[model samples]
Each structure stands twice: as structure tokens, then as C-alpha cells.
Target chain A: MASKASTLETEMPTEPTKRLDTFANPNPDRDYQIHIRIPEFTCLCPKTGQPDFAEMQLVYVPDEACIELKSLKLYIWSYRNEGAFHEAVTNRILDDLVAATIPRYMEITARFNVRGGLYTTVVARHGRPPASLERSDA
Target chain B: MLDEAGRRRGILAQAWPAGQSLSPAAWLRHALQLIALIRRRRPSAEIAAIAVDGTSGTTFLCDTTSGRPLTPVMAYNDGRAGIEARALAARGLAEGPASGPYGGPAKLLWLTRHYGAPSGAGIAAQASWLSGALLGHYGLMDEHNALKLGFDGSWTQILRERPFTVRLPHVVPAGTPLGPLCRTLTRRLGLRSAPLVVAGTTDSTAAFLALGSLPVGCGVSSLGSTLVLKIESPHPISVPEFGIYSHRLPKTWLVGGASNSGAAVLAHYFDRPTLARLSATLPLPTSPRLDYYPLLAPGERFPVSDPRLAPRLSPRPADDRLFLQGLLEGLAAIEARGYALLARYGAPRLQRVVTTGGGATNGAWRAIREQALEVPISLAADRPAAFGAARLARAGWLDTR
Candidate 1:
């Protein structure tokens, strides 16, 4: 059970707990992560209340704060009851991640298989080495 | 964002509250959205510290006394500006960009001819309007966006030349302090008071911020429907033949030009469904059947200055797929030509390009662009201008202090 804090709201299914294989200190003291997954991941449209099927694999590194999987799971679950276009959903997730965990290096790529006769894969990444990237002056 | 024709454009950055189009209130609404987002992230943020950068050249009519915008802004794309453009050209006062039509002079001319635009409190680009709205004083335009309007950022002229005698906005370099938003707005907009509104910039300039700092030759390709290429320069290169603009980089100029051809043509034949079903059949040829000049419903600029232009496909393919693939090849080739143009204008010859837009996401498209341009072209690593603006806001606030 997640330590429910009054300041933050999170929902976790209580039917039958499926132990998630997760951990910390993977980077020792540095900000980095390497996630391993087995395909199947799903959610529902926030508006139509229809299921939005997707297979996702995420790998992120943090600077200030790292994402909590259970919380992230609930967040993703929340999307199941909401509705949004794919583009909007993808960006909204990225924005939420960035806001939730101030990561130093992060990359999220959504590779949606064929849908409505079109295949769309959207990716957004951000990373800043301690100093500004060479040529930030332009 | 780039248009279907691949023209890199600045965002209006104003709120579209249902049916509202052009007005100071709309501009303020947009600013409020930014403020709300920022406040949610940085609760104690200051107010007076906002500077608004908007789409350059798009003109709006504003009322003086009440500080309201006139209904239905005479748009930048309105061809009605042609008379003014012609008048300026006839008087040897007009300059042309790589592509024809949709320029500041043309829009302004359209304003004069159609509206008989009377001198209001002021007239300026989308950025200036927002800046004026934020500060309550209609006295500024960031120098970054005024170059297209005949306002000189170097000597900061127009005060003398009275270019067009159209009251232009006060030009400030990006990041300049515009003081705080009035306490009235701060309280009304929820929170954050006395925050500094740093002189905001054009969406392109903010995009440049997303590109990181400027040096020379560092070009960003906005590969949307319309392809727009902008590169930083150490000096001004305002040849009308190239469609370049002078900016506030002081030592740098932005070499930009639009493509009269873009995705609209591709969309004409293939919708999202057809494209998915047929990516592989788009011809295996490394070159085009005919050296193509891709265009849409109208004529082209850049390669041709003729305005009454019509979209044409040569060596017409026997099938829709063949033609589209051929069209893609031709556009890819033009992407190369655009880069070559930037190089010719003395922007540090782009060795690699960062792209953001619909076209850039297509793997096959990226391959074609990379092969034709003979350079590594990568999609932007972040979101669009909003990311750029957010990054700018974070860095700018730090710099101003």
C-alpha cells in the first residue's frame, strides 16, 4: 500500500495485488534508469470512456526527483477514465512526468501500432548537461 | 509551427476563448494562460516580469481609449495587402523574400488599401500587441520581430524614417526588462505580483532558444507542411532575393525563406489512411522523373516570384502513388536547396538540422530529407514553441536578476 499523503491524491486497485518488480539505487548516486518490460500495457480514453490500448516501455534518469511507479501507474490509470487525442495524450504525459519528477535526463517515446489506417509514433526527450549545451547563445 | 507550405511562423500566443479572434483582451487571456501554468509550477513567481513575443507581421487593429482590439484582425495572409506591397515596390521601398506574398509590407499594404487604416494608438506584430496588452502602455515591440516590418534593430530607426508612418511598437531585444504587470492584472489573474515581464521574443527566436545558444551556421529547420529554414548569422544579409531578416542578435541575422510547396499537396492525394497503407510503393528512385516545383492551390515564391501561380505536376505519374512519391522526392530536393540558400547567405552552412513538424516525424521522409540534403536531419528533442517559451521563461527570469 502506498503511504497515502493528504497533499497528493493517488488511487491503487485493491482486487488482487500484482507485485511490480521495481527498485531504486540502480544508478547508485547518479540519475539514470534502465527499465525492462514485457509488452502489454493499456488504458482508456478520458472522454469517450473507451479503452485506449498501447504497449509502452519507459527509461528515465532523474536530477531532482524520480517518478514513483505506483503513482505513475495510478496516473496512467486515471487516463483510462479520460478522453484525449493521441497527440494531446502523449504531450500531457510528458508534461506530467516532467512536472512530477524534475529529471536531469529523460526520454519518452510512444510507438503506436497502426490505427485508423495510420501509424503514428511520437517521441519527446530532454536532457541538459550541468552547463548549457554548446551554442545556447544563438 | 511550420505551415503546410513549410513556412516557419510565430505563434499568436493569445487565448482563443470560444469565438474570439483578434483583440487586446484575447492577448491578455493568452498571457493569463501562461501565467496560470507558470503559477501552478512556481507559485511565488513575480508578475511585472512578463514580456510577450508574438507572431511577427500579422497586423491587428486596436482601439486607443479602451485598449480594445477591433473585430476581425486584417490577417497577415490576406492578399488584400497586395496594393500596399505594390505601392512600396513601385516606390523602390519594398523587398521580397524567397517566396512571394504573405510578407509584412504586403499585409500592411492590404491594410491601407482595404481598410484605409487610420493611425490608431499603434500597429505591430502579434508579439508587440501582447507586450502592449501586458504593460498597459502601447509603446513596445521586441526588436526580434520588427525586422520584417521595415523597423531597423541596429540604429533602431523608424523613429526617423517613419517607415510607412504606421506607428510601430517599441522594439526591445529579447530578455530586456519591461517592468511589472500592473497590480490590477496580477490580482485578477489569480496570483503572482510585481513579476518582471522580460522583453519576450518571436516564436522563432524562442525556438532558437530551444535550439540552445547561437553561434553561426546553426540552423533550425521547421519541417511542417510548409518548410521554413532559419540560421543565425554574424552579420545582416537582407537581400530581397533570399527572404532574410535582420534581428536583435546584434551581431547576428536570421536567414529564412518559405516553400510554396508542402504537405497540402501530399494530403491532396493521400489522407492519413492511404499514407499508412502505401509508404513502401512511393518510388524507389533516388531522383525525380521530372525536376519538380512542388506547389499547392496557389503559385510559388522563392524559386519563382510569380504570384498568380498554379500548382503543377510534371511527368505526371500513371498512378496516384507514383505521383506522390515523386512529389516527396521533389520536396526533399527543395529541402536541400533551402539549406543551400541558407549557406549561400553566409549562415554557418548547416551540417546537421533539427526538425519539428508533421513531416519530420515520418521515417521515410526523414530518410529522404537526410539523403537529399546530404546532412544529418533530426527531429527536435522537445515539444513545440510552448517548450521553447517555457525554457525561455525559466532562463530569462534568472538572467534578468
Candidate 2:
């Protein structure tokens, strides 16, 4: 009963959750691209605990499933208080998205606003791993 | 914030809230809707012409035949073309302020290759594409949009040796009337007559135009996420080494340079409330000489074009107010040096500076910048880019008609 109840709760999200949810792709064969831009993204700096602002762009080609928009928004908001380097955080976002959707291809481009005096843009990508391999490669 | 004289003239003001991250289609639709709404509200007015100013570097590829986007629009801040830019730089094709990955040309190459060259597709900056969409033409670009695309007096040369053949747009001067709004658009919007669609400039240049005209030597400094200085000059200034270039105006050249130093650094260090608090306690100390070269990384393009330049934010002062003041003073010094470098490179003398962007709101920083620049620093005319575009529409197309 407990396991069933937990599964039911997970299936029907009651609030903004970190767990990314996905729906079956309407066009499984076509290789159309999905682009999402998150402009007001904020995270904490690992070193100073100060805030880092970035406009993150996610473009992907889904395989069998596509990410749900509300869940993706919540997934992004989860990083609000997290402290990570630009490169690491960008790659992690890509990693999470690819894992959630098992996308054929995914790219995360995070343009971090100038910190000291330089603007940093970190682009991370993921391609489809071999089907024989059980895990998606970063 | 119109000037006293402008206020007296009583130019009609309208506000339509806008946002970032709009696709090319959305941008066009919103623009049409906004114009239609304005006309509906004021039935007595007849809009003679329309001019647009899009986000400066935002670019997209379109199929000329259908006037439909072939790929997702690459925004100004989108840096997906880093590898393509590196390749161009390796071939010595990357030059000028727009050589970076986010530049229009780089984005063009990336989109072309990525989409495998859809037939009859041409890449264009946001303003060019939007203007063309309105006028029912395709592959027409303005000089400001074409500059980073390597459009010389006549043609764009993406390659140093040969003309770029990816359906390059025909270049036109700003304020030149392209044509009337297409029949479909006119009928849809319920316009009595097809409005003239004038050639447009980039958003930043349009903002400069919104300054309501300045003297030859006068300049404007935009202290947004980055710092930009533009001054009017008789002759064009092209210093690719310092990331400086000039855009042609009707009479003079708008010589300009940009530095990646400004409010972004402050936002990175402190939140809004904290910054407001720190700023309130300013005019603190001009002494103790905290002459620092603040950078987010080890690179600078203007006033000092060292890619390996290191950021200097050491010797932490215990007082938060002191630290804030030091950063402000450091930025002011950079601004001063930037104007000096421009003058050294044959740009106009620093007659006066009209300040724009978020940092301009800081009065203490303004005082510091005034002391550093040794020139009259005043707030820019507080108006949106739409107002500038409207001014261009009036001056370039409406008045002539």
C-alpha cells in the first residue's frame, strides 16, 4: 500500500518538484528540435556564495519522450540555492535532461553574465549512447 | 526621461511591455499587434511609416520564398557558435566587434551548416529580418546589421578573399524606405493605407538616436552589463585590434568601443538590496588608492586589448562600503581611459557624456565618473527603443511623405 501510494504521488505531482517528468513524444520518428530559454536563472557561486546569473538555453532532439514544461521549470528552479561552477553546472543540467528524456541529442548553452569583467558561456552536449550500453554517456 | 525641451514639445507616449526570449515569429506577431492596438485606440492618427530596432546581434535564417524561419533564432547572448568563430578566426576571417561566437556572421555560419543549407534561405539580423517581414521583401540588411557581417561599402566578405555566397542580403542605408507594408499585413491590421517600411538600425544605435541629437563631439556611455562608449566623428574609425569600429550616420560616423566591465560585476558580487544599501552609503572615500583593474576573467578587449589581462580584486577591504566604492572608482577609471583611447585612436574629443543603462542610476557613481572623466555627465533621455524607432519612422519616412 505504501509503495503504491508513493508511486501514485510521484505520478501526480502536487507541487514544484526537482524530479523531471516527461510525456511520450508525439512524433517519435521526426527529428525536430525543442528549444527552451531560461533567462532569469540564478545560482550561488561555489567560492563566494554570491549569486550568479545566467541565461540558459536548452536545445534537444527527443527520442521516445519529451520533457514536460512545468517539470523542467521546477527542475531549473531547484538550482536556485545550489553552488556550482559555470561549466560544471551547465554540464549537469545537460546530464539531467538527457537522463530524463533519453534524448537522441541535447545541448545546454549557459551564458553566465559577467562576474568580474568577463562573460562566460558554457556549452555542453550529449549524443545518443549505444543501445547495448545501459547508461547514457555524458 | 525626455529632456525639458522634448517634454515641452509633448511627443505622444505609449507603453507596451516587452520581454526577452521571443522567437522571430513571436516578435513579428507582437509588433503587428502592438501597432494595430495603437491605431485602434487612436483612430484619428495615421501612421505614415514604421521603423524597427531589434536586439543588436539577434539573428535568424529565413527561407526567402516563404518568409518563414528555417531554424530557431539565435539571440544576441546565444554563444552556440564558439567553434565556428574559432574556425573563422583560424582562417583570418574573424574580424571587428562581431567576431565573437555570438556575432551575426558566426551565428549565420553555424545555422547554415547545422541546417545543411536549406534552398533559398538567407541569414539576417533581427532588425533586417523583421523589417523585411513587414515590407514583403527578403534578404535586405542595414549597414549596422551588416557591419559585423563584414559588409564593406558595397558587399559582405565573410571570407577575406571571396564574397560570402550563402545568400547574403542586399545592404541598404538606415532610414531608406524599403516599400509599403504587404497587402496581407495591411488588411489584417485594418490599416487605411499601407504604411511605409523604412530601413532600420540595431537596438543600441536606435537608443543613441533617441538621445534627441547631440553635437559632433558629444558621446554616450552605456554602463549596462558591459560598458560601451560611442562618439560622433567626421571620419570612420576602424581599429579592429581594440575592438573599435564606426557605424555610418547621415552626416558623421558613430565611432565606438565596448568593454566587458560594468554592472554585471556588481550583480555578481551582491544582490539588489545589498547593492542599494552599499550605494546609499557612497561618496565614501576617493583616497587609499584602490586602483584596481576589475575583470571576471583574464581578458580585456578595449582601453587595454590584452586577452590575457588578469582581474585585480585583491586586498579585501573589511568595510563593504569601501569595497563598493573601489569597484565603482575602478570602473570610472576604465571609462575615462576608454574615452582617452578613443581620442588617441582619432575619434572625437570627449566633449560630454550622456550616460545610459542601470549603473547610470547611481548618483554617487555618477559623481565619481564625472570626477574621473572630467566632463559633464548627464542622464540619457529616458525612453524605450520603440520611441527611437518611432523617431526614425517619423524623420526618415513620415516627414518626407
Candidate 3:
């Protein structure tokens, strides 16, 4: 019976923050998957200092705690001005999210825009989904 | 009108009509509008004096006797007199202000050529004509406006040597009292009495006067759409190659230049709300080391006067806040370079900087500028050019008495 304002007040951070937040999972006993599509991820290219834009897909299965959506968004925004290679940034994101939520399984797939006539996609993962929840999409 | 202590008793402003062409009738209308507003707000108030300040180089030809415009205004930024400017430079007026296409003399030449120089037509700076309209007199222009019109104290020697067939206005120092406001305007606007119409100055000089007074070596950086840096110097310095010139003040020279980079480029990317929000979030000591020359287009004046110079705003970072910081840093660097150039050209070394215009309100930008300038920075008085004009009017009225 949460009011819309009350829900938003509880959920959204007052300002952009780099610290990711987590809440105890509502249904920790269940084996459901959480899929997040971040369409506006950006970071600087390490060598050239030019911007590199990418779309990221994060899929994870919760163990006991769930990553807070708004905090995760802000966490992703923190890398916007940082210079990092595509492979490195994707792995770093996966590591940070895994460390925060301590999920049973997590994966980050980043598809970057074309540069110098080449498009790059980097995929990084931690742990594995339970055998019963395994899928070919990965 | 301001009190003896220089505090405003009343103030009003009217927006100029939107157009490329300047209209004398519009100027009169706006003046009347301001007068009526003042009368409405403070019926008991007695306006003692009035003055006008206009863009330094904007000028047009007007009938000598009738005070009617003979040609459209050549705006301060208009550059249609390139050939005439080059011709003047070829004749050895190269180092003077009048050799620029946007300067008053070159534009006057262009007007004469296209409009067919008629007899009884005299040139008028925007401020001169507006002031004359109030006094029912024409042909008396202040020295600040007259500078760009080839008058440095005396009509520039070259102009005196080859004199134009077109008449030149009698130049007076700024704050000179011309006469009383015409009886017709006094009655039409319902003033208690005719106030003295003082000879005014160029707008930048008016802005400087708004700061009350500053010692030599104090610089005023106007962070408007373009960055203009003016410093008070003991002696005149003129370096036309760097697009630098000096306007003669009562006791000192106001030396400066304008650059193409400033808050306009920030506006190109961020609106007010976004700018404020991003500005607040910007980390202190916000040097991203992005060497961006954030020009609106490919030309620069002052510090680097190359007409074909391209803007250098590449390697833009992904974060909006970081990009904003980079732009601010670039502007601060340009301002520093401007002061350095002025000093190199024999102007006084800047001891302090007072910031004016829209960008003055930005705290983050101010911090960045202080770091770059290596001088104490302060905000200007929250007064417009009109306030400075009122100060001039007060001085002129007192002098006449």
C-alpha cells in the first residue's frame, strides 16, 4: 500500500552517487532472474580521450540481497568521465555489482559504438546460474 | 536618479525591439517607456539629469540639421567595410582603431559609398544620436564613441589630413553637459522639470564606471556572450595587430580586447537549469586538462587576432559535468592569456579582476578563473550600464552648475 511519492522518496537518491545500495531480496528462496538494460552508458577511450558510448545488459540471480536500481544507475554514471578500455570497463562493472550484491550469478555485456571502422562488444561474468535456471541466451 | 551617495532611487529597463536594423524611433519609444514607468512608480520623484551609452562602433549617417537618420545603423559587429578598412590601412592608419572593418570610420565610408554621400549628412554614434534626440541637438559626440570614428582626443591625424566630405560631429569628453532635455520631451513625458542631458559614453565604459572607481591595473572581465577584458592603464596602448585599442578616460586609458570565446559556447550545450545543476555537482579544482578553445565559430579577436583560426573543442569527454568544467577552464585560460597580452603590449599588469555580465553569478567558474588569473577576483556591483550613465549625468549636471 505504498503511495507513489513515498515509493519514489524511498527508492531515488537525492543526488548522483557512486556508492551502490542493496536491499534484502523479497523472495530470496525463489530462483528468478533480474534483467537490466542500460541504454546510455558512456566512458572515455583510454588512449584518445574521446567519448565511447555503449549499451549494457546486466543479468543476475540474487542470493540474499538485490541491487537497488537507482543506485546502480548512478554507479554506472560514475564511470562516464573515466578513461578505460572496453574490456576493462565491462569487467570492472561486473566486479563492482557482484561485490555489492554478492549474487549467485552475474553477467555484463557491453556493446560499444563503432570506432576506427571497428565495433567492440565485451562480456564479463562472475559465478554461474543454478543448473535448473541455465539458458542458451548467455 | 541616484542619490548623493550613488544609491538608485528608481530604475527601469525596456527591451530593444528584435531586428538586425536599428531604429531611432524605437530608441525614443523605449526611452519614453522608461520615463513613463519611473513616473508611474514614483510620482514625487524629480529626475535631475539623464545620459545615454551605446555600443562603441555602431554608427549611422544623420541629417545635420533635422537630426534624421540618413542611413541604417552599421551594427558594432558588422564587417561590410573590409575594402574601405584595407584602404585606410594602406594609407598608414593601420595601427589605429579606424582601420577595422567594424570601426566607425570604415563603416561611415561604406555608408557614403552605398548611400551616395549627400550634403548636410553627418555621422552619429548610437549614443550621440540618442542623446541629441533628447536635447534637440545633433553633431556633439563623446570622445569614447568618437575613438572608433577616428578621433583620439583630436580627430585622428590621418582623418584630419584627408577629411571626408561627410561632416564629423564635435567630440567632447564623456560626462560633458550638452544642454537641458528639450521642452517638448519634458512635456510629453510629463517631467516636473527639464533635466540636463549629459554627453554619454560607450557602453563598456559605462559598465566600468558602474564599478565606482578602480586603481590602475584593475581589470574588468565582461563574461557576456563574448569575453571582453578591459584594464585601466596610466598611458594609452594601441596594438591593432592583436585587435587591442585604448579609449581615453578623464584621467586614464581603458585598454582592452574582445575574444570570441565565452559563455555563449556554454549556452550552446547547456540551458540555465542544466548549467546550474551541473555547475553545482562539479568537483572543486575541476581541471579536466581539456585544452578546449570553445569558440562559436572559426575567428578570434584579441589575444589572438587571426580571422581564419578554427575553434579547438575536440576530444569532448562523455560526462556532461566534465565537459562543462572543460569549457569553463578554457574560458579562464583565454582570459588569462588576454591579460598577459595586454601587459606584453605595455598596459599595466593586472592586480585584480572584477567580473561582470551573466557569467559573473557562477561560483564554480569564478573559482576556475581565479586559479587561472592568479589574481583576486570579485563580483561587480549589481548595476546596469544605465546606472553608470546616471552617474555621468550627475557629474555633468554638477559640473555645469
Q: What is the DockQ of each candidate?
A: 0.02, 0.01, 0.01
How well is each residue in A27-135 modelled by candidate 2, as lDDT tens digits?
6545567888889888999999999999988887765568889888887887889899999888767755654565666778899999999999998877642243343
Off by over 4 Å in 2: A1-138, B1-22, B159-165, B398-400
Worst 10 residues of 2 chain B by lDDT: B1-10
- Quick one: ranking by lDDT, best first? 3, 2, 1
The lDDT of each candidate is 0.57, 0.75, 0.81
Q: Which pairs in model 2 have colliding backbones?
A: A116-B295, A116-B296, A117-B295, A117-B296, A118-B296, B1-B382
In model 3, how many backbone clashes occur?
0
Task: Write the residue-wise lDDT of candidate 1 on B199-304 in tens digits.
Answer: 6677766665544442234456776667677776777666565445545553456666667677767777789878755666544655446666678766555534
Give lDDT tens digits, candidate 3, residues B137-193: 898999988988888767765554444677878998899989989999999998889
TM-score for all predictions? Answer: 0.67, 0.69, 0.69
State the DockQ, from 0 to 1, for candidate 1: 0.02
* Stretch of 10 with least lDDT, candidate 1 chain B: B1-10
Q: Chain B of model 3: TM-score?
A: 0.91
What are the runs in model 1 whose C-alpha is more than 4 Å off? A1-128, A131-138, B1-18, B37-49, B63-66, B70-72, B97-101, B109-120, B154-165, B190-192, B213-218, B250-252, B282-288, B303-312
lDDT, candidate 2, residue B143? 83
lDDT of each residue in A32-120, candidate 1, tens digit only: 46442314445555566666666555555543244557756655655554566677666656544544443454556666666668877
